[model samples]
Target: MAMPPNSVVPTTEHTTTTTTTSSKPMEVPVKPHHDARSPSFLRLGLYPITLKFEDVVYKVKIEGKGTCCGGEVSMKEKTILNGVTGKVSPGELLAMLGPSGSGKTTLLTALGGRLKGKLSGKITYNSRPFCGSMKRRTGFVTQDDVLYAHLTVTETLLFTAMLRLPNSISQDEKVEHVEQVIAELGLTRCKNSMIGGPLFRGISGGEKKRVSIGQEMLINPSLLLLDEPTSGLDSTTAQRILTTIKRLASGGRTVVTTIHQPSSRLYHMFDKLVLLSEGSPIYYGPASTALEYFSSVGYGTSITVNPADLLLDLANGIAPDVMQEHEQGETTEKDQKLVRQKLHTAYETNISTRLKADLCGLDVSNHINQAKEVATRNHVSSEQWCTSWCHQFHVLLLRGVRERRFEPFNRLRIFQVISVAILGGLLWWHTPTSHIEDRVAMIFFFSVFWGFYPLYNAVFTFPQERRMLIKERSSGMYRLSSYFLARTIGDLPLELALPTAFTFILYWMGGLKADPATFVLSLLVVLYNVLVAQSLGLAIGAILMDVKQATTLASVTTLVFLIAGGYYVKQIPPFIVWLKYLSYSYYCYKLLLGVQYNENDLYECSKGVHCHVVDFPAVKSVGLTNLTVDLLIMAMMLVGYRLVAYMALQKVQ
Candidate 1:
């Protein structure tokens, strides 16, 4: 195992004891660096990771319920990866090439420790078990770019650095690392630009992909695994991304990426290639040597033809008939299978066997002895958290605020709030005391308007960010509680603003209570009710990851609450009285009515020479006499809904 010309071997010292299935012990040298008190990036020396997988097979079970007489359930097993074997040494860029449904992504996920299927094989790092600590040192970039659309590239990377880098690393050092990565990935031009999505245009697709890569690179991973890094990018952009990956590999990190039908020039960038078809390896060797092996197996191509296209064609079992002209007889399915078997056997005999031998038999007693001189550094424990919980909450809160403020349709939301307020105010303009029905109608409209508006708006919150949340949470960037709390706190001000405007317009225009204390209390109650509504929406969104489903559920629940609201049903049925207690709208309506009219207030029943006077009890009739109890109940609903939403988020990842 010789280091590549571009590889940088660390100057520090550490010892790793490799324990195999056998009782014997083997020593391996792992370079160490400055103590934990030192900066993380400074301590990240040439920690080259050599990833090797032998006879790896991944299978998933699909269960179906039986429709027979016994009505039993049956399980079927599907093999995603069949006996896949390969080696990616330090400083080498290995590309896994395969067609759609060919298991390229699956294999990459398996290697990155993100796969959930049943797997059987030996995956080793530095000829030792790839434990949790080593897993933390690796980075995985999924096919989709999971990032904040509102945050600028610099802000995105800085927040990631704050959350993913260890606490021992100072904020200034983390910022430095983010800047270095930004420059390294050629993202300086877009450093201050937002990574926008469909609603808002910002950075280009290529730059967004670069930011995704930078996020994973922030940890200075020893092993970087990417799934389809160039899946949706143009040729030039794809080339640039691969070039960055090559540079990273040249720095002694093991880089493994899955590529789909890359250009010829892009194909040449890979040092090693693993071609797969139907979950089985068709070719696994040097990129330059692949054509030679294919040619020997009757799948050869001319120099002018794109080797990548030809390889993909063969891997897809669609190689042109002309390529098989060398064979004497007509081509058949049996012959194609035979050719594939021959290629597989050739790789097994000439490459896999030799690589395994080198890995098992090669001795570096001198390196181990040198590492033994210095105290064997303890295995860096799996990071419990990259930053403190408070830091995560603060960063997430800022990101949430930015996202909400810059949302493309946010102006429409504000307009909606204003429109609803104005329309309700115009419809019930200055209701008189003589018209008790109009006052009741105004209060009912206020309750229903605030309840439904906030509910629908907040329903999209969790579902929209579900992908980003899952990705970050799985990476151990922050605690779920921090994110939940930050989002709640971040959106509170905006949530209250709209309701406050609505309250201001309706309370005055509808001629509700004009007393200063009563007016302020009324506005507070409405705002709190809006919070409860939004919290319910958040819970629904988190429980159901799909926006349409969450919205439907929210609509149904809101309708139920509206119906049970006190105004809608003045005389409640004994059996369904408990349902009203569960409705936040009911409490809000009762509180608003209580705040507007007092027990001693008089109502004129008849208007004539002789007018009949009657006293109407607003609060006691609806069983909402105590304002404090109503406020307490509304607060409880707010917390209860938010708590449920948080619990739902915990189950998402």
Candidate 2:
């Protein structure tokens, strides 16, 4: 029978090898059934990634504050990963083990093609240099489960499938794929349940982790890289997750993950292990032989103790000898250094040779040639985008609507809008046409209220979604334009709903106008005003990815717009008169006043006396006579602000 691509077929018996040292020859453990043979390169309709890195080094710069005399700031260079070398073949699950700050996550990020630093080395997928195409073939599960809390499990996976799966796959196939993944991850029971967050309780932590895994699996990636997949879960949950990963590897894919102190049972699931300390590798080999190698080097632990814990303790310089001496007040920093040095020296002298020999046998060049030939035969490039622009927009639109509908803040905002509208109506209740001051007060209040509410709500847009956006965009899942356009269009219903309610209540209750056309026009102007305000807020949020800073900036800008809105001071000086033209509120207020009191409308006294004042002077005071011009200007402001927001988002990324 022909073997599947990257699938290993095990034999009944396994052979063992030993390394010879000066003291004695140490017996190596028998290879596990899963790792007994190398996987063959055959076309199985899935590209298997063979990742290899040699002498990978990454450095970052740290900037400190300047001295009192304004001297140059202190700059320091820190190495995150040094001389890290390893190879993970298809059908293998490699676990990177180390203590805190040991550069395990850093190395994982580098291999995922998400790291930005001064990196020097060779990183290849099936012997071809890593490129944007390989990034799509790889799935990266971050430490935290960053998901839409309001979306159900099925919806979440469906959205990912729609955006990440190639367009050649039909909608039916996408749905089938999502269902398959759901069933594979054992999430069928909670398929319709929401993935809730702090405010709501939905699925269990383990279920959430599974959902995260299922999301990446939707695209059927060749290589999966996870950072701390079992970080916050219990032992049972972590074991289940690791088991799922191992099963995935057995299906002819490569899996790599970084884990903190894992239980013995969990550690045994990994096919290979890379032990790191302070950004340097101490040992790299088959997971079953790790303890044997350590024992041969005089660092064996008690049979009852977990080998993973022993490895961590040794790597962190907290071995039994060092810990015992420290408890007895007889250990120093130098003594701890000596213990680490001894382990490193032994691994280099005795185990490195065998590790290199095994890596050399991977035949990465052959795997690369096979993959290229298969991809060419299928007329598909791994780099092709999964979804088209229209498809991406459609998926994003649905997700944005779902998220906004369930957001507690949005519901609260609706209530607040109704309350504020009712209060404003009561405060300026059914005023007479002769009361010019009351009319002006109502119009000014309307302008300020709508502007402030939308601006406040919009400031949270980009700041809240920044991390998710960065992750998705970095993976080349979709273009920035598609996201921006979808988000802007997605928010239209909610954005217009509240303002429409406010206008309807405030317009009739305050006795502004009884004409149907005037009411509709006033409503349209208010909605446009809200959109302009929200666009400014989006731009501010994108420019400053901090909620507090964006809020503060928005408040100040709103204040300036309100002052120049031609409400407080009708006769403005030449120097500051131009500011009114830039304010959306100015044009919105003008349009509202014009629509209510047209050129022929009269403001007569109510005591059966015809006054000389035919209409309120509000239109001419702010130099806005033509209602069409004012409406057009408001429209322009809407588009201009949205354009600026789009540009800001692109620039920031």
Candidate 3:
């Protein structure tokens, strides 16, 4: 469980922490979370930041339509966001409007520093690159809500508050902050309800969306990027959410959101807008004047039409005449493509040149400030992880337990474990020790079943949490060491519970050994084997990151172990018989036998059994002299497998 000293160290230049301040909270139905009533974030003296990007182009190499002579795939460079540009000063809300494939989320991901691959652009916060400080200072909410279904809204927000807020803040303050956020987001009504998934109902969509935003709000972030925050909600709900977002932007924070389509009122609420079409900027300017700007450029607009619907229509290359074509009859894709081309040409000819000019002028100040800002930002970001190694371990461990306590307690799983134990005990009930072969079979079965049961269950652990890990890690919530250690430690007691119960019941009913020392040693051996099995599961799962693939590999791996375990085929080939030394099942079975009989005090001898029972055909490998070696090897595998998993997970991004 111990990690290297540097493993938990933050990934930036260590420096003093800074707190971001915001403007006074706006009046609303519920009380605001800022001003004097805000969370203790004010005491932190954090700085507000402006978001600026220029020439932000993102492209990917995708498979082309045609293949090579030998049927090899052809490649083509596909541009997703073609030289998109904008800037959002603090206290302004900028909205990105585009069709489904127009690169809105991709741009948002880039702003959050979560996008991967070829991105050529100038993206900065406070004239600095996306360093650790801005990472902690920024909050990015994805289009879909990613949350624990079982966690109540309050618990969800409280947990985030505890982990995300600086450790310097007290427990009471964190709770109070959670309460204030609950009121601010109008989530007070559903505070106690669960954030349910597709399988169950909990809070409404708007409430879930609010909880996602609240997670970021607890930090009072300087730069907040949300991808489609009001998507899939009614007009009233969407407006309320937008109103809250406006208030947040009013608090001297730079806010950028992607809107699919907004009502006229919601559209007017935005301070700035970036309109996109087919990965190209068709227009970028003030939200209020977008139509005016477009009208001056010669596209038609009516005052009675909702601006959002009209812009969407224009972005899709459907003009008033094209709508007429739709109303009267069918219009061709060729017509839409022609309109889209005209829009892009106008943007490039008129808007693109001006934006580039402004950007060229801005670059001088940026380069002058870049060096100092980087040093300062890195120093601040390095300090933003907030808690000591032990502190992180403590909180993560508790959260892990609370989050997973119900997993092993599921009624069907519980019944399965108990029923198997009872079934096994009945099958081998009170067998006489003289039946040496039968007793050995029982011990072997115990070793194999306990080892196999946990491996499959453990294989799914990392895959399920992969998205959560990436989200939290990108925010610098906790070091990977803390998460890995906390997860392994928390799972220990629960994973061991069923196996312990199974062993206690089976050992007595089967009457293999009555001595307390012998039973205790037997239980330790089984648990140790289980640990090794689960570690292997974790390693494979982390390496593959796909449940089905990991399970297939695990199944094949354990099958090899089972065959070489000296039971199914006692005579293994010399080439692979060495695998027995590697099989946890083999070592466990041998250890089980070794624990039953003492070296000096033998006397279980019979004509059919070896006088030194440890030397019995089923138990003896190299020698009982190597028992400690066996334990050491299994112990190495236990820790070694987990270390492999932790290392592999670090590459998962």
Where in model 1 is the C-alpha error above 4 Å? 1-41, 63-74, 127-132, 296-298, 301-304, 318-382, 572-577, 608-621, 626-632
Clashing residue pairs in candidate 1, if any? none
Best candidate (score: TM-score):
3
Error of 3 at 313 (Å): 2.1
Could you tell me the TM-score of candidate 1? 0.85
TM-score of each: 0.85, 0.87, 0.88
- By the lDDT metric, which is better: model 1 or model 2? 2
Off by over 4 Å in 2: 1-4, 8-44, 296-298, 301-304, 327-330, 342-362, 373-379, 571-579, 598-621, 626-636, 651-653
C-alpha local distance difference test of each model: 0.76, 0.78, 0.79
lDDT of 2 by residue, 170-193 (tens): 666666666666667777667767
Which tens-of-lDDT digit does each residue in 298-353 have in candidate 3? 88766579998989988888876568786676877888898899989999898889
Candidate 3 worst ten-residue window by lDDT: 2-11
- Candidate 1, after superposition: displacement of residue 266 in Å? 2.4
User: In candidate 3, how many clashes are counted?
Assistant: 3
**Top model number, lDDT:** 3
Indicate the TM-score of model 3: 0.88
Predicted structure 3: lDDT:
0.79
